[model samples]
Target: MTTTTRGTMHPRFDEILTPEAIAFVAKLDSAFAGRRAELLQTRRDRARRISAGENLDFRSDTRHIRADASWSVAAPGPGLRDRRCELISPATRSMGVHALTSGAQVWIADLEDATAPSWENVISAQVNLYDAVRGRLDETREDGSTITAEDSPTTIVVRPRGMHLCEKHISIDSRPISASLLDFGLYFFHNAQALIDGGRGPYFYLPKIESHEEARLWNDIFVMAQEELGIRRGTIRATVLVETITAAFEMDEILYELREHAAGLNAGRWDYIFSYIRTFAHRGDEFVLPDRDHITMTTPFMRAYTQLLVSTCHQRGAYAIGGPAAANPTRQDDEHRHRALALVRAEKEREAAEGFDGSWVAHPAVVQTCQEAYATVLGDNTCQRDFRHGPITAQDLVSLEGVPQTITLGGVRTNVSVALRYLASWVEGTGAVAIENLMEDAATVEISRAQLWQWLHHGSQLAEGPTVTRALLDRVIEEEMAVLTRNAPPERARHFEQARDVLTQTALGDYLPGFFTPYAYVRYLIDRPLRMDGPLSPDDLRQSEQVATPVTNGSAA
Candidate 1:
């Protein structure tokens, strides 16, 4: 099958989007697209069942897989063994430099949620990695002196787009391909050998995976890509993010399926919260989450999830990575800076103290804080297989009845402000931004909007007495928009307007959308397939009026 690129091109994109690479991606897509579709349908069916009051429990069929104690995942591969602290950033040049020089043990070059997945980004990220692999990055400092990027000891991992998305820009026989395959295939095809030759490998961080079946699919791809590329079979390694509520139950099964290729699991806080809301959104108010800000790592149910991850990974002889501190101290004011770092240190200290082999930091600014905590806890930078916390029950996984319902108008306003600002940046081609000094990405937006939708759906009452209604949401949004867009130029203000439309449709519509990215990507990111031979015009950046529904149905509650 021949694959064609429909998106506008940038300089040197041809180097990454070559015919050979396209063919490789097409091959993987052809093999897996049917299974991917079936799995997506299965997700919908399972979600419907749960929404209809069916309960979630560990799969009876996969019980033996978990009960068996003889099996274990392969040990961590090169440059990944001691992941004391890793950096997560968009795969952009500037961010890449900061990540590499941040002194973290691993740099996850995020092409998934942290990236906008613009075709330019798709190509440029590959180009950047292609260069970084060969030690060819050259940049000039502010003082006008050029510095070759450090050949840092940090390992590199790439996160592909999740299964829910497709790379519409690249098509096989006029059909779009899985964004996951496009990302994984292209990166593996181009750089696997180079990485192998350098004693590193084409490592990946799988995202938003809900089942061990998905992990099996990735393992199959790893086998095929390595065979096709003529690399060793076990050369590739992947750390799965147990982000979704469903995935939290299948941690052992997921590892069992990817045992040869599985590196470990990372606790994904925001997406886990988002998934919890979406999975149980239609349930009674008992399940309605409080303000997202209140859902801390120590929250009873959340602690249960993380404890399961740590116990599961250590039991299988794999690394158990923790969530990021995500505090960019550089963005904090002086008074707030000390407080932020203190909070960051405390958070990292808890993760390390809990026997997490390592953790993540969003910005380079907090890498040392993470390292300091881990270094003090894990002097040798390795974990014993003695994770003492476990035996977490299904009720523990699904328990949210105990959390206090502290919904407030302030929480509502915060969600609106965050969703609008983050969506604006995402549609404008950036995926990661610092909001109030914390790293705000697609996952954060998901948590914020999903909580908003859940509160409004359940008619949850705020501490200030009024119930959540469309009128209340609209009023808060209007007040927040004025603050967000004040002193902005026309184009800038219009961007914020488009962002409001996105938030309205995703958060206030009759039902909550599965994700805001796909919603906004179709309405805002897609443009006519015109060549980018010149500068982008106003027509290029504007949202598509064809699908512009503002979702203005009001409620009187």
Candidate 2:
């Protein structure tokens, strides 16, 4: 067997800097180093907003709007069929640091079902993830466009092990375990703070949020961290995963509680559906939806869940992110790709119709489909003249009537005034400006530079227009494909094969303390095909025998 040495240690930020970059670093240092008063004030303001039931309008605060709803942007419509696929890596050790850095919108560096458990592997995985994000220096390809220090896509998010034990969840016995939990969280928190301190604040996606109280717990910890470690507030927001039935009901309150440091809510479909079944399994007569995969967003429970989430978020003024379709990536054949594209197009169209501003895309290949979906719905610039600047009403949006943009189109001076201001923002960000249907003031052309600044530094909203074109779509595809195919490219494919092999041979059996399963460690009880009687406790393992190789083959059946 070949033994590979761990690569050289990651370079710290301070070690690689030119004089100007160093000076810029110094300024950023001052920004976080000496701002207790400002941090406190911001936190208090955010707390007040949460208290007032006003979730933040992230568009007005943060500089970027998430494409969380981008997944289903074109569903149930012309461009696609009603299909969504989960983007699974099919790899137990699915850490695609290179592929993720190359261009995909989000990378679920999974430590859950996609990974196996071993303390060294777990720590190595976490450390690997940290180093990948912390910045790695590699030579640019000869033909590859020179990526400046700034322009790489922000596309990695971790789905760490949940409370469940299927993956990397730590457990000494058959019971719930806190082992490695604190170490993992602390490491993540420290690096996350370092990232924020380096100016990319609050960019984490926390998964498995089952209740409002859990969200509160996270918030409390965040506040304590800010006070104790001196990380700035409003600079470390997280997107809470709404994956459980309890979390669905507590959505509003969860958003309210975590308002200050919350980026938005994420709809985690698979685990969510799984949890739903587990939670309500006892209610024989209860109207539980069919099994997880069979339940679409159109399913009554799912529809209500999604709509409620959208309504709650919009009502509280937070972004309503759609859930992942958990869609499959494109097949190797052209027919498969075409069919998948059609499905993607349809799904995205429906998501748009359902009022989601953005969604998730699992693969680099799928990003074009998602972007195109958003473009088809959001690209129409005709509504600019219709914007009504009057006190915006919920009813207008509900009926897609009397919306500020629509009401303002009647040539009301107030509407036009607000539209003009909005248009100014659009123009400043990009060279062109169009809101709803009006061509921006041609005279505002000079403000494009300033608008660019606003869009990059402050979250500015834009009404869709021609900017989302086929050319741009083709460009992103070409660029992303280059990244995906570079440097012995099918790297992820290798890992996928490894996982498939593992699953194919893995057997089903119980490693219970007193059970007769092979490979069961006497000290550690393990089981699969979970029994309804509940897991065996630590006491059960006291007299157990230690065994290994529980399953002779991957298929337990």
Candidate 3:
């Protein structure tokens, strides 16, 4: 074998990680690893410039790409014509079953924020996707029920890990490979042909892209993968996540770069907020965001962003998918459930009115609500590409003045507690957790903690009349840690401590790190072997406590 598997072996995993598959990924690593490193370094360099009083604006050099009017992306690929509702979930066996049956137009098999990059998670997610593509995901459960689709199955679109991460479990000649390449290569190599035969293309939602050149890299990768697999050039379709402020400026260039394989662009609100804070972490209070709850879609800056996304996508003949609706209907209260559904419907109503072709709902219960909202706007139509929104400018995109800075002690406490709980679950190999009727993922953790750092960095005042001090942060974290430590089982108490370690390292540091996932993954989540002979419950996360420590503090990026 040309590659190494540093993780445990099990049934069906070997099928996914065959020698050919590993070799294919190894080739991809050797080819693009240099460029990936250079681009990541470029991000760090750009961040340094932003920190040194440089503001974000449209690139002068890429003006022609935006000014040109004759270009349009390829038509919507198979199964992507009407994406009015897309269900986003991690690729666990059960979750995969539910998502495919949710009656949504698309199911984004997310390997990024919705998943933590544990060895067991990274490999087994591929197994779920493999079984799903082959239509055997639900042969028989131990409970003896067959997985049934309520209607036609949803289209599957995979979102791989960002370029900044590494797949430490599988390596080439003692060197780790890019996690992005591994996820993309394994899926495309194994299932591209099968998907095409089934009348669906190998689709993807690209995440964390910061520039047009980065989009170009993905385009070249798609081209080469198709050629290697003997598929057509434009058979692979991708939707770039316009989540970063930098990418927001270059949306035109990004779509142009991947025009042949481009599906559309999505308004990723959570990560965009995280990026906003991180981009301006070194600045004064002008950029400090209030509580995450207060920063709704109606905020001036967010409206500017969504308006720009819709116009750009329509101008380029691509679908403009909106952000998540952020409500779960599973909570057990008649009044509360009705209220949540009402809010979810209203949110989708606004998106449809603003010309979004589709929107995301985290749970199955809200699917019909989203569908109804879009149905009103797009009756018998697949998308709103014909509808056009008015124009916007660069200053409107970056101006945070209209947002009310109602920072409160409650907000600080909430950030600390939520960050603690979410990080704990993340290390336990459960990426999506339900807390307070909302499903929280890595993006939740990013914005939660980044807001803390940004507020503290500026000494912003809380509504309770005290400045956000390191002492205040330390006290709040300590209190939240005590609550978590008390509630945790004896075997799982260490996870809480580890969670606090990650929080302090990321949120309370002198310099704000670009992302906490890379550092935390390398330090704590790197090579814990799981007894994957059966489906794992939350209790099984502590299967083996013996682990080797990896170097942390932003080195993984």
Top TM-score hit: 1
Stretch of 10 with least lDDT, candidate 3: 548-557
Best by lDDT: 3
The residue-by-residue lDDT of candidate 1 on 482-512, one tens digit each, is 9988998888898899899878878888777
Q: Mark the 10 consecutive residues where model 1 has the least summed lDDT.
A: 545-554
Sort by lDDT, best first. Answer: 3, 1, 2
Candidate 3 lDDT, 511-557, residue by residue in tens = 88778886677667876551233432322322111112321112111
Local accuracy of candidate 2 as per-residue lDDT tens digits, 393-483: 2222112121122111111222223223332232122212233322232122112211222222222222332222324333433343344
* Candidate 2 least-lDDT 10 residues: 507-516
Each candidate: what lDDT?
Answer: 0.84, 0.39, 0.85
TM-score of each: 0.94, 0.50, 0.93
Superposed model 1: Cα runs more than 4 Å off? 530-557
How big is the RMSD of model 1? Answer: 7.0
lDDT of 1: 0.84
